[model samples]
Target: MSTRRKPQMHSSERARLDPFIVATGDASPRDQQDLMERPFFSLAKAKRVTPILYKAGYVQVEVYAVPEHGLATIWDADVLIWAASQIVEAENEGLRTSRFLRFTPYQMLSAIGRQTGSRDYKLLKGALTRLQATVIHTTIRNGENWRRHQFSWINEWEECVTRDGRVEGMEFVLPDWFYRGVIDRSLVLAIDRSYFKLTGGIERWLYRVARKHAGRQPSGWTFDIPHLHAKSGSQARVSDFALDIRRIAARQPLPGYRLDIEREGRRELLRIRPVKLSTESVGGTVGTLGTSGAGGIGTSGAAPSGLRAQDTQLTLWPETLIPGLNLESNLDSNFDVGPEDGGKPAPDGAASRSDTGRSEPVSPDDTRTREAQP
Candidate 1:
C-alpha cells in the first residue's frame, strides 16, 4: 500500500523554525551600553509637550502624539538603552542579535535599575506603547538635499501569554534605523549606571549632549548658554533655561562629566570636561560607578572655582542678551551640521555622523518659567 508517510524534518531545519530560548537568570552577565548621538526623545514632560515641529538650520524634527496618548519622554529612552545594551552584549559574545528580541519584564526592569513591582511593569508597557505610537519625521541621516524620513521608535511589538492568562514574556521589533546604529560599533558609548539616578529632565539631556560632544576627549567641549538653549529644543524661555543649567551645574550630578561656567565679554559659556577614570574612582559619590565635582575642573586644570556656587549663576546684560539667538549662523560655525560625507570618518571615530545638527535653542522674552514635571 502506498501509505502517505509524513516527511521528517531535519534537526537543523527544526532549529531554524524554533530556536531554543534562554531565560534571564541572576547570573546572566550584563551587556555593553549604547546611546543615540542625535536628540530623538523629547526632554520635556509628555503631558506638557504639544505636537510641534522643531527646526534648526537645514535640519528639521517633527514629533507627533495621539489624542489621549502623550509623546515619549526622555525616561522612555530607558527602553532603548536596555535594548542597545542587550544587542551589544550579544554582538560582543559572538551571538546573533536580531530586531525581534524576547525578554521578560523583570529582566528589562532590573537591567535598567528600575523597580520590579507590578506598577513598574504596567509603566513599562505604557512606555513601550508610547515608543511605538510616537512618530518622528526628521532629516537626520538624510543627505543635505532636504529629504524627509519618518519612523516610530519601535516598529512592532507583542506579548506572550500562558494558558492561565499570565504574561510570560514580550517580543518587539526595533526600527531598522535604530538597529543599524546600535550594531555599528562606532555609534555606541558606555554610560554610567548612575545615569538612572538623575532626577531632572534637563540634567539627563545635558548629560547626553556632553557624551555626544565631549566623548572621551581630554579637552572636552564648550557651548554658549544661549547657543545651548537653542540646541535643547526646550520650550522654556532663555532665562529660565539658563537658570536650569546653572542649577544643574551647582549640583554636579552628571556622571563622567565635569561642569564649568566661564564668561567671555559678557557671553556665558558652559564647558563640559571628561573626568579621568582615576579621579572618578577617588571622588565619585552618587553610585559606586564614579565621582562628583560641581565646581572643580578635571585634569585640564582650567579653574577649580569657576563653577562654584557663587560663580555658577549667569549674569545677563540687556545688550549682550541675544534672547533666542539666531541658530542658522551658530549651527554652521560651532557644530558639525552636515551629514557624513560617506567617505570621511566621523571626528569621534564613529562610522556615521555623530550628530545631524544641534537643536535650536528656544528664546522667549519672559524670564519666568515653570519647572518640568516628572
Candidate 2:
C-alpha cells in the first residue's frame, strides 16, 4: 500500500484555522491529566475494535473504534503528546497556537523517538488513520452540567506531496476538546522525553499515570491493584492484569519514578515514587520542567511581569475512593463493539467510571533515575 497523501488543498482546514508551522523541536513533553488517568486508548499493538467504557466520579468516557483502522493504540498517543508539547511550549512563550498544525513527517517522528525511515513514515500514517477513526464519548471538562461529547482524535489530516511524488509536509486538526485541554495550563504536565523508549503498552500507560499522580510530591502515591485494574481499561482479566503490572514493577521501567507492588492482608497495591535525583518534572504551575526555549521555541514572546504562584504541596486531585462517585454493578466489563456498532458510535452512550488512585513509594535510593531526558 502506498503511504502517499494526495494534496488536500481544498479541505475544511482552509475555511477556518490558520496553519501553525511546526519549525521547532526538543520541546519538553506534556500530557493531559484526564487522559493520563483514564482508559482512552487500546494498550496493545494488535488490532482492537472493542469499546472502552470508563467512569471516575464526575468523569465518564466511552471509546469506540472503526474496524478498518481498528482502535488507536497507546503508541499512537505519542502524536498527541508531541502536539501537546508544541502547544504548551508556544503558550508559555506568549505565542498564539491553533489546533491546526503543519510540519514535516520527519520532524514529528524524530521528536517522538520513532524511526524516520520509509517504513516508519508508513507507521506514522497508520497512527493518523487510527486516530482519525477512533471515536470518543467523554465528560471530562464539561462544565457544571452532565453532558457528554463524541469526537475523534483528529478532525481531519493531510500531507503535502510534490509533483515528483516526494512528501514535504503534513497537517492535522485536533478535536476541540483535546485542543482546549492542552491550552488550559492546569490540565497538562511535563513528562520525561525517555517515556518514548518504553515499548510495552502497560508500562507506557503506567508511567503516565505515575507522572500525573505521583508528581513531585515527596510522599508519592499508591493504588489498590483491583482499582488500578479497573482504571487501566485493559482487556486482561484482573489476575492477568495484576500479573502484568507486577512484572512491570519488577523491571521498574517507568522513567523518573519507581514502582513497587506491595501487599496488605490479602490485597495487592502498586506504588509510585519520584526519584529525588530528578528535578525535571513540571506539573500544574510553571516549574523547573518548562521548555528551555531551544531552537526559537515559540513564535511570540514578551517576558512576563507578575507574581508567580508556587505549589507548596499537592492538593484536591481525585482519590481511589472519592466519596460520591456512584459505582454501577457492572463497571468492570471488558466489552467489544462489533461491525454493527462500528460505523457510527452512539453519542449518548451509557456512562462508566474509573477511580483515580495513588500509591506511596518504597525507598528513594533504589529508584534514582537519570532525571528528565532532553
- Scored by lDDT, the top model is 2
Distance from true location, Cα of 151 in model 2, Å: 0.9
- Candidate 1 lDDT tens digits, 288-357: 1101111111121111111112111211112232123334432222232232322223333323112322
**C-alpha RMSD values across all candidates:** 17.9, 15.3
| Model 1 TM-score on a 0 to 1 scale | 0.66
**lDDT per model vs. reference:** 0.53, 0.63
| Candidate 2 local lDDT, residue 29 | 77
Give the TM-scores of the predictions, in the order they appear: 0.66, 0.72
Relative to the unseen true structure, what is the C-alpha lDDT of residue 113 in candidate 2, on a scale of 0 to 100?
52
lDDT of 1: 0.53
lDDT digits (tens) for residues 277-361 of candidate 2: 3433222121011111001112111211111211111111112211232122112111221211122332333221112221112
lDDT agreement of model 2 with the native: 0.63
Count residue pairs with overlapping backbones in model 2.
Answer: 12
Could you tally the backbone clashes for each prediction? Answer: 7, 12
* Deviating ranges (above 4 Å) for candidate 1: 1-37, 143-146, 162-165, 277-374
Model 1 residue-pair collision total:
7
